[model samples]
Target: MAESQDELSYSLKREAEKKGFQPVGIARITKSKRIKLRTDALERWIEAGHHADMNWMKAPARIEAEKLLYGVKSVLVVGLNYFTIPENKKPNQLLIGRYAQGNDYHKVIEKRLKEIGKWLQTKRPDSKWKICVDSKPLLEKAWAEEAGLGWIGKNSNLINSKQGSWMVLGNLLSTEELIPDKPSESLCGKCQKCIEACPTKAIVEPFVIDSRKCIAYHNIENRNKDIPIEIQKAMGLWIAGCDICQEICPWNQQKIPISLDPDTQPKEWILDLTAKQAKEWDDKNWQKKLKGSSLKRIKPWMWRRNANYILKNNKFNSSK
Candidate 1:
């Protein structure tokens, strides 16, 4: 006998938990008003050029689940808490975003998702499943909210009331029908801490970030292009990606559960890197240190470029 939707949803959540994904929830595929609102917001964001040079965000598949996975009936969203409070910073240390401090979450989460896919195959041999991490063309954050994992905070990061905004999200689109969870309601209210805190004012409005002005975007995705003078001036010591907005969010300030996954822990080598080392690293050095790290997205030249900004800033500050 086939299991009911409620029974299947409960079993799926249990299975996901066993695979190390916490706060998992299911969202049935539907063209609901909330989904339409999210799609419209994404269309506007892209139309406004807020996605920067990431042309992939403009893919039609991003707005339509069936385009990527035909007959996809549900999305199982999961959040892996990657939050790790940094150790005291030593002088001259270059900062890498907390998410990239450990192993690449794309690899870690995709591996777990693949495991879940295999588990699902046993239950429904005829069902199709697609695993997606950050690289996929899916509206993962919106689906996460739809799944009740978290609401998109003012910083545009998914903020779980219990887990905070320090999670990396992954999705599993499957043909299996599952009972959907209620969507999360935004809790940001009128707080403007993230907006007031941004050095680049990247968050032009609440829950909307302009990637052209985002430090993380320039450092990680803007490849080979000269960072705008205004952005360069605000770069500070961030060599790979910036977290100023998340750092200032009250949701992130709350007592949050840190990830216990060994793969998500901060690497001492990454934590100890300095601007000097970054500027001096040869291609060989870059390949070795950044191996298996999400920071590898920042090319050797990009590293030098970002590091030079930090060095220049330090000199300017000291001279003052």
Candidate 2:
């Protein structure tokens, strides 16, 4: 029974596949009619001040799962693969997380999401919808979980059983009915590697991260002064974002080449620069190599700031 056999959601899934949404699953976001524990988890995280300087993540948070896609009867959850070559993983070689190796995913994923929304509208002319790609403060991991995209691993990133944690999530919130997918179970069972591997102990509890100690939080969100000295050194080779927890997870062991989505390819400039060269990197080089990049969010001075710490630890030695 299609929500509108006259308008196949399954066909929408297929079209999304051709357009490069590797996995497309629909999860309805119905009104809860009652305020629930969604607020409890959010309140707990805020009360503990785990969000750190990102006070914005505190207000207007969702947890009950359906509230995110509110007023929308169905959510089309999508994932885009963004993994790249291993050689590009070296710290001295101008490293970056696999996702940010190309243009910002927010732009890339949103474009494709709107295309799906467009197709749905064509099938059902009266459909109403919106495309979201982290642009809104939705707890994407929760949405992903509900849509069977993956489990929010101990690292706090969505880890697909097949693709590891190397994908960005996108969604189409619609005011049309569709069956919701079941959430994935935690395959991480008893494996505490990601929690243990966080250099700053950011994973204070299972699936609960304290951003104050998270390198990714400090590097991108905490925009004042030099990062705390205690964690600055622990921040280590994470020039922009820290992938330490994901890297150490057993789930990421199955490495595969991402065949689609230009968003996954590694850039040459980011792959070949020696730490010394990256240090001497001029304004022109920064713009050319990292423009429209997530790195741009970190003030230019912050790059020089965080990179200098990694440099001193290696004792000015480009190879350590």
Candidate 3:
């Protein structure tokens, strides 16, 4: 006998949890007004140049699910909590974003999603599946909220009531019909802590961020160019990506009960890295340290650029 949609949804969630995904939920595919509004907001954000040099955001597939997969029926969204207790840093040590402190999440999440997709195939042989991580053009966070995994908070990071904003998202789109969960409602409620706490003031307004002013964007994505003088002055100890907004969020202040996956735990070598060392690393050193990590994308030159900014900022601050 064929399983009911609810039964299938429950099975899918269980399969995802067994593979270490938390807060798994399903979202029915539809041309809803909310989806339209999100697409429209994305267009406006791009028009205002808030996306900076990420030209891929203009892909039409981001706004039209049909472009990605024909006859898509449901989206299975999952969150992987990557939060681990941070290590104390020496004054000379440079900071990296928490997400990049571990092995590449793209590899970790994709491997898990493929396993879930294979499990679904056994249950629904006719179903077609497409997996998405951060590289995809899909508006993943919107789908995540529609799946009841979490709401997008003021800092524009997905905020789960239980897991906080430290979770990375993944989606498995399928042709098989499944029950959809209720969409999450935002709980930010007039709090402006993220906006106030931004060292570079990148969060221009609630739910809006200007990537041109984002330290993470400049450090991680802006290549072959010098960081702006004003942004350089505010760089602090960050040598890769910035997390000031998420760190200041009240949603992230509470302790997360679940232990982090071993693959997502901070590597000791990454913790021991200092800005001075990053600025001095040769190509061989860069290749060895960041071989399996997401921070490899920063490139040796980008690392030097970011480290230079941090060292200059420290000198200026100490001289004051």
Candidate 4:
């Protein structure tokens, strides 16, 4: 590459790696046809009421990316592997989602993204930039695919060939032109394992999920005083975000365990929590243990609700 071309984004990948971001790529902004497909899909999803109570999905801000960052020339899409296989030897352990097993990813990702943004700003003194960690309305997975990080799996999670689907995505949009990498190919060939394995049949179709039937949505986003009986029964032992689809996917089976961060480990307390103890935990205790953890997003009452529901089923006390 020519010197002028190399200066387009000032070695964005190298700068991101310095801050411990991997699976990073730069993509030029344009009226991409792929983005149109994603927006159209979102419209259909919202119209079908699949978004459930997540009214934010219907907002215009989330419907378009150009409006979010007008005159945007490039997007620096990055992924951090947070996949850690748990050692749940006991049968009584409550199952919590792998993503929330550690500190809040929003905080971790944003901090790293800001550092990259600062470096890019120095390189392009006159350009504007924005750092996003799923906080904005932008289509993060779509951009990640366009940037060559990964392809959107049939289960709707981004699937990287090397890192699998166990990744947290973050982005840096800038008004500076940069060389864009070729988009990744669709690697999920005729795989229906994720769609077939869902307990609530949340994966209604390939690449589509109905939040109305999704346990993760009910447990995390649904603020209703009581969970619907059908959904609750289908929840089984999932006390937090559900990871059935990801776990079933063959892509996630092969993991570079030593490469991922150790902070992603689940707390010992979570592994040993029981329905009776979870119900007795006070507000002060809840805050103290889950102070910086993503699991704290669910209130103590909600925690008890999930635990009790699992206990009622007596299905299996298996924790993923």
3 or 4: which has the higher TM-score? 3
Query: How much lDDT does each candidate structure score?
Result: 0.87, 0.73, 0.88, 0.81
Q: Please report, as a residue range, the 10-residue window in candidate 4 with the lowest summed lDDT.
A: 1-10
Score every model by TM-score.
0.96, 0.89, 0.97, 0.93
TM-score of candidate 1 against the unseen true structure: 0.96
Models, CA RMSD each? 1.9, 3.1, 2.0, 2.7
What C-alpha lDDT, on a 0 to 100 scale, does residue 264 get in candidate 3?
Answer: 88
Model 3 residue 61 CA deviation in Å: 0.7
lDDT over C-alpha atoms for residue 310 of model 3: 82
Model 3 lDDT-worst window of ten: 311-320
> In model 3, where do residues sit more than 4 Å from their true spots?
316-320
Residue 44 shift from truth in candidate 1, angstroms: 0.9
Clashing pairs in 4: none
Pairs with steric clashes in candidate 3: none
lDDT digits (tens) for residues 8-90 of candidate 2 = 77787788787787666776674332123334556788899997877667536344334454467777888888876566256
lDDT digits (tens) for residues 61-105 of candidate 1: 899999989999999999888887658987767788888888999
Clashing pairs in 2: none
Per-residue CA lDDT of model 3 for 1-320, tens digit only, reads 97887898899999999999988999998877777777888899999999999999999889887788899999999998888876777656778898888889999999999999999998899889999898888999999999999999889899998889998889999998899999999999999999999988899988899999999999999985697998898888888888899988998888775546898899887788777688788989998999889888888989988887887778533221
Model 4 residue 311 CA deviation in Å = 1.7
Clashing residue pairs in candidate 1 (N, C-alpha, C atoms within 3 angstroms): none
